[model samples]
Target chain A: MAQPDMTRIEAAGGRPEAIRLETLRFAWPGRTSFRLEVPEFRVGRGEKVFLLGESGTGKSTLLSLICGINAPDRGSVMVDGTALADLSAPARDRFRAERIGVIFQMFNLLPYASPLENILLPLSFAPDRRRRVTDPRAEALRLTGALGLQDDLVTGARAAELSIGQQQRVAAARALIGAPALIVADEPTSALDTARQGAFLDLLMTQAEAQGATLLMVSHDARLSGRFDRVLDLSEIAMTTRGAG
Target chain B: MLLPALAWQSLLSRRITVGLTIFAISLSVALFLGVEKVRTGAKASFADTISDTDLIVGARSGGVQLLLYSVFRVGNATNNLTWESYQDIAARPEVEWIVPISLGDSHRGFRVMGTSAEFFDRYKYRGGRGLEMAEGARFDDLFDAVVGADVAAELGYRTDQQIVVAHGLASFTEHDDKPFRVSGVLARTGTPVDRTVFVSLEAIEAIHVDWKNGARIPGQQVGADAVRQMELTPGAVTAAMIGTTSRLQIFGLQRWINDYPEEPLLAILPGVTLQELWDLIGVAETALVGVSAMVVATALLGMAAMIFSGLAERRREMAILRAVGARPWTILALLSLEALLMAALGVLLGMALLYGGLFAFRGWIDDSFGIYLRITAPSLRELWVMGLVLVAALVVSLAPAWRAYRMSLSDGMTVRV
Candidate 1:
């Protein structure tokens, strides 16, 4: 399995695309009416892409597949040059932890933990990510600081005590920690007002660019597409429609 | 370690429910341990009541009955052994020493035991510890009385205080004509010996000189001083405790006493009879232990229910953890860790409550129930019970932990609830 992927990754300038999906087919077991198929999809290294999709359009399902939380029925999901289908379940989880950082639309922080603690949580599970930082606490503080969170709020307040915008910024800092090769955000700015949304996106993009990580953010909002290097519609990428056997 | 920290923080977040669950479990643990402590304490004190005595000779009856009446001062003897039989047993070459006991009297609620002054010298309790006077000397005169510590404390009787003996358990059948002076007060023995009033065998005869058919003869009342002057040889005694010259001769003497041809008599080894008594009442003790164990189980189930119900509200938390790279088993471990921590806390708090209760009520329990509760480290049996409780908690915790594991697996990175 590694032979072909190694050659293909070498063919792609010696550094694999951040995410590559080829002839991907998926369907929730016991739900035969809804199938998702994508002939080809790719995100190059350090590329910022906006994935536009509405609710119930297989957006979360696609993210789950990319994260190796769900296996594809056909073809392969290669993230950072490794084939997810070739790894064991636990190895795939480790791969996700080491190479991909995910931010949810809401409730992205553990309510009991401080923002600084939340930002450092991924390191607690992934030693590879933890090894990338010289000092975990100092790095957490730096990331939160870069995301516009105050030192006091990041250090003292629980994640639940922070405002909505502050919490999203904290989540952004958490997703950007350890310089993971890919950052996947699922409608991360939906909970924020229009002004805060644009500002949060700018800060998030700036942080991603500074880390030189690819960003694949999914949202239905079209106005935010101009800021990304490339934009793709979920309907255009996924060829199968619901209930169309 | 991170899982444990997360579990601790999660528990702390729901401190109210968690605190109440811990308190409930602690209460049950305390009850379970308290029952076990009192059971063993009562058994130890009962066994400690009389030692070094080879046999207790009483009129033919049940061995447990003889032990209850002769040693524990509980219940009435079916019949009394004649003074001649007692003398015959005492004169045996194998007998080292003997003390005769005459019952059927009371001062207030305390049983009045009439025995020779040699009883203070010959009888032993709590592993050969002799009786020590807390106030004055043992009874010497015919009308002199010696009270146990609890009798003196409860009735406020001191050396030289006068007390009239009742004919039996009834308060109205008092031998008011021959009031006895308290000559001594014995120190606390943590046994039934601490609840008795001792008088001379002659004193028992003197008090009943004017009484017949369980009542006083009209115009035949004997004054206390005159009764002391009269011959007071006891015609019969309720029982006698005998010590053999050698431990090897005890069984021989016991057999001889039990087979005495002149009278229907029973001779029992105090230790054997005490064990027999326990065997008879062991059912009640086992029932008490079972009930307490059930209480502990109920409290632990309540804790499991609390955690299981809390799992529904924690789907988002599980999703967040999974999104942060925690495995499904980590979620399972987190729940189990939480349960274990609560159980461990409950056990610690329960021990504190048990020791605290013993410290506060040790004297009162000893006085009221004649069972001494020593403030020492927990026994091996008690530690075993605590260990079992933790194991049970861990076992019960697996139900919810497994549920959480399944939920986290299926709800990967996206929990609807």
Candidate 2:
């Protein structure tokens, strides 16, 4: 009964799902820690969802477990119908590189690398990062233009040299560079000033929408919930808490 | 993921740590190679000292000390043999020829030896070869002298220059009356003889004629005319070089010399005595090498400590690499590469330090102890040791690499802290 998203839509007369979680038992090993028993969760292809939860609500850990970082003690996580639990560590890393994009909350970008170099990292690791774009510079430029990163910053500016807001944009550009099927941003704008957070999140969601990327953004802010096509709160839907949400 | 520039940047960013590690490694390499270079050179020079001579005979002493004083001029003689005893031994049928030596004096720290003219004809060195003079000839005349190549070259001793005999083993010659003329300069033998001056027995006697108990007896001095009438021969000499006529008769020669009732004497084969000397001095070599190895090992520990200590601080950096799809092993590989690269740099710098140090202080070493250090680029031994040290360093430094691997693996989406 993987029916977490009850209002599933039909794309061209057939149902489509990008992410699925079933009976996922995620927990910290020691400290008699509580575990997250995910009964069910699903995201449709091309969907944008802002997953909101307070601090320590097990949202980040859910994202991690779904991304194949931590294996569920029971049940499974499925990315495009493939069980993440079935994949080996190296294979899991490869799958994430090719199909998934993650933007961390703070210092998400490699500090020493230029903006473009940081963006190009997915291709450096993921074998499938290359699509029709032959020249990485050209692809990077096109993506940077779409994201509205500064024109000068497009040419190899170190990520640490940028402002906090700029680092978020650079990470978004990197997440979108490979046109991955799914992009997850875990409180990506928490460190940015209030004035810049909206702009960065809007840019990230709009770009993922343009690339046909299913976007799942986790945030503690309740106000951002309505901006997404679907909104979910960990306290309302989360069956268990294993780690920081 | 392991681009050269990236590795270079990582190393550059942590320069203080890298530099300190490199410095520690280089110091160990320098000390290790320095000791090896000096020790090997010393052995080569000492072994190369007496090449052709068979035996060294002295007044009943250990073979090594006998060779030490007679050939290397390293110590004073315990006793001297009377001329009558020397002649008795030389007259033996087993003896081929004898090089009777008179010692115990120097001119400015260089040893002076009074020997018969047969020395020039019989003495051999460095592979049974005779001495090759860079400039003059042998000291055949009783009042003539021959200077060694280094002595002549260093002190600028010219042919036909006059020199007087010193009273003790070094400096302040006793006699100014009879100044011996330099007739020849011996070639570089790389032996202690390179610092010695060769003079005849007649010159030794002539210089001491007016002196009693190593002084010009107050008002009792004998004139040069009357000194010629007095016995010009020395009563005794330090030692003699024995060349047996038959190899089978070597034991006979040793027994005969040892059994001589008139004088207590010791017979030593120069070749065998040299082996004994090497055995006696081997302990120092082992101790020196042991200390140097410990120094090198400690430096490697420093490298591991420095890199592993930085692991916690670098967790974020490592996670960034992971997010970009860098495998955990790649992170480990980079760390190991850094360790190995730093060690290699240190080794090269250490070699340079050793060569420079040798070049700066060679003269002092040679002049102080008469040990001429051969300074050259790294030898096969040094290269092999360097390769082994680097390999060991890499293995020991893997602790940091292992830490890096674990960090990257555990840092899934974000840093733990």
Summing lDDT over every window of 10 consecutive residues in candidate 2 chain B, give the lowest-scoring window. B1-10
* Candidate 1 stretches greater than 4 Å from native: A1-14, A29-34, A239-245, B107-110, B128-137, B149-161, B168-174, B187-190, B209-229
TM-score of each: 0.93, 0.81
Q: Which has the greatest TM-score? A: 1
Clashing residue pairs, backbone N/CA/C < 3 A, model 1:
none
Error of 1 at B32 (Å): 1.4
Candidate 1 on B1-417: residue-level lDDT in tens?
788788888888889999999999999999999998899988887888899998999999999999999998989999999999998998999988999999999989999999999999887887888999999999877789999998988888899998998988876878887888999999988877788999999989988888887888999968877876788898999999998899999888888887899999999999998998998889999999999999999999999999999998899898888877788888899999999999999999999999999999989998778787767799999999999999999999999999999888877775668
Inter-residue clash pairs, candidate 2: A36-A240, A57-A245, A58-A245, A59-A245, B60-B265, B60-B266, B166-B173
Residue B139 CA error for candidate 1 (Å)?
A: 2.3
Output the number of the DockQ-best candidate: 1
Share of native interface contacts recovered by each model = 0.53, 0.40
For candidate 1, give the lDDT of residue B234.
Answer: 88
Instruction: List model 2 lDDT by residue over B1-417, tens digit each.
Output: 435556666777778889988998999999999999878877766676776556678898777788888988889888888889988888989888889888887887788899887887677765576777777777866668899877898888988888776777754546666667899888776677779999887778777776777667677666545666667778888888878888889987888888888878888888788878998998999999999999999999998998888888888878777776677877887788888888998999898888898999887776555456787767888899999888988898788899889767665665676
DockQ of each: 0.66, 0.43
